[model samples]
Target chain A: MMRRFPQIAPPLIALAILLVAWELGVRYGFLKPYQFPPVSRIASGFVELSTIGFPTGVSIWSHTLTTLVRVLLGYVGALALAIPLGVVIGSFQVLDKLTAPLVVFCRSVATLSLLPLVIVWFGAGELTKVFLIGYGCFWVMLSNVIAGVRYVDPVLVRAARTFGLHGGELFRRVVLPAALPRIFAGARMALGVGFMVIVGAEMIGTIEGLGALIMEARTFYRSEITIIGMLIIGVIGFAISAGLTALERLLLPWAGNLDAVRR
Target chain B: MLDHDNLARCALRRSEAPVAKRTTSPFLQFIAINSVGKTFAARTGSSISVLDCVDLTIAENEFVSFVGRSGCGKTTLLNIIAGLEDATQGQITIAGRPVTGPGQGQGVVFQQHALFPWLTAVDNVAFGFRKSGLNKTDRRQKAMDLLTLVGLEAAASKYPREMSGGMQQRVSIARALALDPQILLMDEPFGALDELTRIELQHELLRIWEAQRKTVVFVTHSINEALMLSDRIVLLAPNPGRIKRVFDVDLPRPRSRTEPRFNALYEEIWDELST
Candidate 1:
């Protein structure tokens, strides 16, 4: 049924209707200026944040770039540590048993819960924010990597062994490739964790990232800027996920979209 | 360490012996009851016998098949042959030396294709040659050659999902043959394909087999398939699994289901299998 209609038309019309309703509600005094800001006001706010800048000097682009850098740095650090370590734990049953409880406890602990402790240790610097982001991303990635390596089908390993593949050869050829789809899922999840942590971390002590922009705008009653900041954050999150999906497609061409290698 | 050359000479001498004829004439010869058996510990701390006093010799370049229902220890026997599982009771000697574990010219093809999804058809085949003495350029060329032999040259660069079920299994066969093993142990490699694709591949496999002439011990439930492929079929019955019957298929190459002899043997085996 949907195929018969113009593909983009329905969604476009729905979005237009929503914007009109929102704009009219504010103008007619049915909705307040603070909680639910008008679309027109948010549009002006986008322009203001880009040119006039938010919090006096830094523009929206600078804040987005800063946020992006923090997420990337933290995410990369977490993966670098987690992937190898997870492979070690996952490959060995004794090690998996030994660390199972520790991993479970760590993952259950809230990432934001570490914020105060991190600030105390690192003195509220960029290092503290990065550490929190890494901590959150690390656990998520470690678990996924462990799951990836552990869940390799037994048949493939048997097939590999018959071909003179044993020790490192078996692990590299059969286990690693077999576990790739799951490992790719872990990387994607870790990035998301890093993004979420950065937002919460940036809100605390930083004045240069998007989260900070929203906090600053809220205090000054420029709530339209706060709304704009949230939209930008959402857009960035969506783009990052979509980018990772494309990367998965390019790297793991055989993967089905079955979420079998779940995050 | 008397010497590997001396051992090879002894293996050649023993391989020429008469007892090797009853089993098979495959290059990778395995002789059994003089070999050994396997035992498994039950969950209740008791032990169960998987294979007991079981010994069979295979000749060079023979086509053999093992047929049985699930839990009939057919797969366990195959696993033992592949050296994936150790025997608890007896000893197995390949070419006069005791079987230790996997990796002495044994290549495997599985029921599920088991082709690495991330790899293209050519790359998956090449994975078998990773440990080969050949260099990178030669290994790749050899893999491509094998793919061509399997008639998947047109789809050589395609991933497993991009190919048909039959094509993937053909790629799997090519992957197995890439190692140039003396024996190929297949665990229902074509069982998952549809009827049409499966029959087409059966002919394709026959062509490849004629050229390669490797020892093949296939496992399957399809009576016609076993008759069509095997020079000898070993049937096992469950409940403390053991060999039930062995049928020699002497019908001509490229066998037919409609053939009187083919149907007769199928009926005989089917009766034994059901009974």
Candidate 2:
């Protein structure tokens, strides 16, 4: 099994070699340090910021933690609201048709486009950023969930009926479990939307997020800090996505391939 | 030939076997449709009668097959018996009571495998017990038992997608059995499989049926299949479908298609079917 699995090599070694070449290019002045900072410069920038802070006293951990908390709050709230509503809307063709145009229009109205309106309503505080992330995540999650329910194979429903399952029992036992793979896919997509929205939302009114940190570094000509913030954002995105994937595998162990379910 | 009065008496005595009690109730074990007919509205708003005044009685623990070509309303009749659709006229009864809606004694296996892809083989089998007053563990246990009955204990944890086509049909059969209805209704359950798999499943089905001894109403298009599996084969003709003839298959268990008697029955049914 170990031989078949290609157990000797990891992708990290190749990535390290590339990073070294990039750092050398910057050091030899083949590439400008400011436009494209090296790994050493980014690492030093991370250490300096974490110790002395990106702003005056707020550390790098504080910024990342703040962003994580806001996104979590909004994403969880959206899921709690969307799933039931999506099930109801998805199960009924009439309800889906009636809400189709409304859902489309709302999805098209970009979350950032509502930032000005949100500020007027909730002020330029934390509420505005959370609301923006919530707004973005909700529709993407809801649409995918509704589609998941609506598109379930009718053969499964017929099979369930033959078993004497109907009404709520039918929905919970058959419909919901059958729709789970797609719903999990929707959740993964929703998390992505929330992440993107939070970054954009935090760039303006707060210095306590990766987005704010990067923008602040650009203004102070600490380009190295900007690079570190981008890398941190990338790492966070990768980790969150992988976490959701593992969770999906755990919950729906019977799911096959998962190409359609994993966005 | 069986007399009408004798058939009626038989049906009336065993109509409630699967519905009222789990015990070996002699009162309700058969499926009887008395002068039942189905008519559906066409796209042009004209009504098309699918079945007309169809009357049949399948005895307790009998394997009855209904055979006809496509558009012959065989599947429609099975649906009516299953209570999936209401007959436009006449009465259809299972276990003595008129079928108004689904979920009584009718455990139906479709032409398609129809195993739930999301559930493992055992889980799909036991899904019928969802409303059967069984707890989670008990239902799963029953499901496992049914899968074993269908010779699928090894693949109990495998999903529908993971199993072969014949294996999927086996799971579907096991799933229908989980309902534990007095009557098992199959609408061309092996019609979708290849020649080899289909023949293998037919034998597997006979074995399972012999062990379970549930009254069965099977629909198929093939004359050989009907002659091979059924105790009585009901031949129906299209264009306002009605039963043309009912032949009692006297072949013993595991009857071969190459045997003289089997070939004679096949030719007999084929002639009746084609004409």
Best-fitting candidate, scored by DockQ: 1
TM-score of each: 0.89, 0.84
Residue clash pairs of candidate 2: B14-B27, B14-B28, B14-B29, B15-B28, B15-B95, B15-B96, B16-B28, B16-B95, B17-B28
Residue B53 lDDT in candidate 2: 56
Cand. 1 TM to true fold: 0.89
The per-model lDDT (C-alpha) reads 0.81, 0.83
Which DockQ-derived CAPRI band holds candidate 1? medium
DockQ of 1: 0.58
Instruction: Report the lDDT tens digits of candidate 1 across residue range A1-263.
Output: 77867888889999999989988998999999887888888988899889979876899999999888888888889999999999999999899989999998998899999888888899878898888889999999999899889989987777777777788878987798888888888888787787777768987878999878888888988889888888888898888888888888777767865355433
- For candidate 1, write residues B52-122 as lDDT tens digits: 44446666677888998888888788777777788765556666666688776677888898887778898
Model 2 chain B: which ten-residue window has the lowest total lDDT?
B16-25
**Backbone clash count for every predicted candidate, in the order shown:** 16, 9
Candidate 1 has an lDDT of: 0.81
